[model samples]
Target: MKEIQAVKSSLNAVFAIKDLGQLHFSLGLEIAKTKKGIHVCQRKYALEILADAGMAGAKPVSTPMVKKNEKLFEQVVMHDVSAYRRIIGRLLYLVNTRPDISFIVKCLSQFVQAPTKQHHQAAQGILRYIKSSPAQGIFDPKDTDIQIKAFSDSDWASCILTRRSITGFCIFLGESLISWKTKKQNTVSRSSFEAEYRALAATCCEVQWVTFLLEDLDISVHHININCFKVP
Candidate 1:
């Protein structure tokens, strides 16, 4: 704590700063410190989103998205494109603390330029899901072990319009999830194996970056488990 105080004191000496005492809320994220860990969420921000969409009392859904169907591919453009784009932008920010919604947000982001009625509906479904658990967020345990693990997966040709693959992965520090991403691959994969390989390669790069980061922080990573599905 003294080291942190000294750094803060030095910064204060050089630049004007106000001590916030403790982090409870910042940039839409709400932090709660506990004996188990530090929990972070955006319940208030989520509520605001729901209120903006006039879905404050909408029925909650178990899943953020529905099964892929023909309706989703229809090019019937939405009348108000800006509203859809604004919702998507807010949801993108919400993904910072909601990993469960990461893939869906990535999927919806593709339609921002020309969102359709179906796309707008899908975005609203995500809001309904958010209503289910507005307080859901990542937890960093206080007694977490110094171990790194990652899991990677890919869906071959999941994009109906482009036939491109989507890569998703999550990295864990002990039992706490620290980093995750859901991204569409730039090129199309010929086979599932190729898709899986790309996802695994992306995950490996993230692991390497994370290991270097830990080393910089003087935290030695003795065990790193990078797990992926066996390619057939």
Candidate 2:
């Protein structure tokens, strides 16, 4: 636990907050320590989302998106701009607890410029799915000190307008998920390799920062960088 102690020391040293000796919550993510396996969920925020989004009574969905729904997020987002933006904004926050939907959420996030009825429907569907499985969350055991490996992927020319690809990445510590993200490239690329290369550059920067953070914690990683996968 030297890594944990070192990181804690760094954080405490920088923030000047008195160390409590245990972590229950940080960065909006809740933590529960125990003798048995630990579970992490957005229990408190999930309820709030259900109530506020008018989805408490909606039926549960097995998947984030329905099958055969070929519409682009921008097309669906053109109907109700205001409501779509509001719900999507909330979903962005909810992703902290629901990484499973990270990719879908990032895709839908693009249509805030002009959300349509289809967008509202799709967003509502996601909320219903969450309502049905509010207790779903990441699980990290109380044991283990192994380095976890992950993969990042991106599909080029995915955006109809910009032809920019979508980038996805996941980070793990032993068996616990420490970070994950999927996003659209800011610039257009002529080929899949270019897109993947740009994504690699961006992810590498994150890798360096995370590695430094781990170093401060005294945790060691035999392999620090995650594998990046690409497709045209």
Candidate 3:
């Protein structure tokens, strides 16, 4: 408080500032304080997405993508491609608080330029899954070690159209998930080993950036562990 007041006093001559007390919402994310830890979710934003998709009362599904290996490129083109794009865009933002949808969203994003009816159905599947638990979010426990760990994997030539590999990774700051990604590789790998190596490289780059960020915040990472899960 004293430090904040001192900074405010110094800045008073230049600019006016108002105390917001605490962070409640920012860029569609909802924040709340709890006994366990800080609760962060986008329940309101999620419901808005469901309503926008016209799936407000749709039946929930046990999983986001039931048929992960289904051929996405062979489907018929969607008449309303903009709707699919909009839903994918919204899902991208929702991934900020819901990492569970990352992989599916990443897959769906590939068809943003020319989405099909099959793509729309897959997106609706995501909405149905969200309907099951709109309030689900990441929980950051207060008490945690200053450790950084990550795991990465890749599916070689997953995309039928481009034959590009898909890579997924998750990073944890202690026991709390801090970052994750599911992205298509820019280049095609000849073999699974090459794809996995590319995934590892991408994960390493992310970890390096995160390490620098934590250092800027004066938080030293004590333990670092990285595991690459190979798919046989």
**Per-residue CA lDDT of candidate 3, range 1-232, in tens?**
9998899888887888777788999888899987778889999999999999899989999899987666577667777798899999999999998999999898889789888888888999999999999999989998889999999999999888788999999999998999999999999999999999999999999999999999999999998899999658
lDDT of 1: 0.93
Per-residue lDDT over 43-71 for candidate 2, one digit per residue giving the tens place of the 0 to 100 score: 77777777887778888888887742446
Rank candidates by lDDT, best first.
Answer: 1, 3, 2
- C-alpha local distance difference test of each model: 0.93, 0.76, 0.91
Q: Which consecutive 10 residues in model 1 have the weakest lDDT in total?
A: 65-74
Say which candidate scores most in lDDT.
Answer: 1
- Residue range with the least summed lDDT across 10 consecutive positions in model 2: 68-77
TM-score, structure 3 vs. true: 0.94
- Residue runs of model 1 more than 4 Å from their true location after superposition: none
Name every residue pair that clashes in candidate 3: none
The local lDDT score (0 to 100) that residue 10 gets in candidate 2 is: 90
Please give the distance, in angstroms, between residue 1's alpha carbon in candidate 1 and its true position after superposition.
Answer: 2.2
Best-to-worst TM-score order: 1, 3, 2
RMSD of each: 1.2, 4.5, 1.6
Regions more than 4 Å wrong, model 2: 1-29, 67-70, 73-81, 230-232
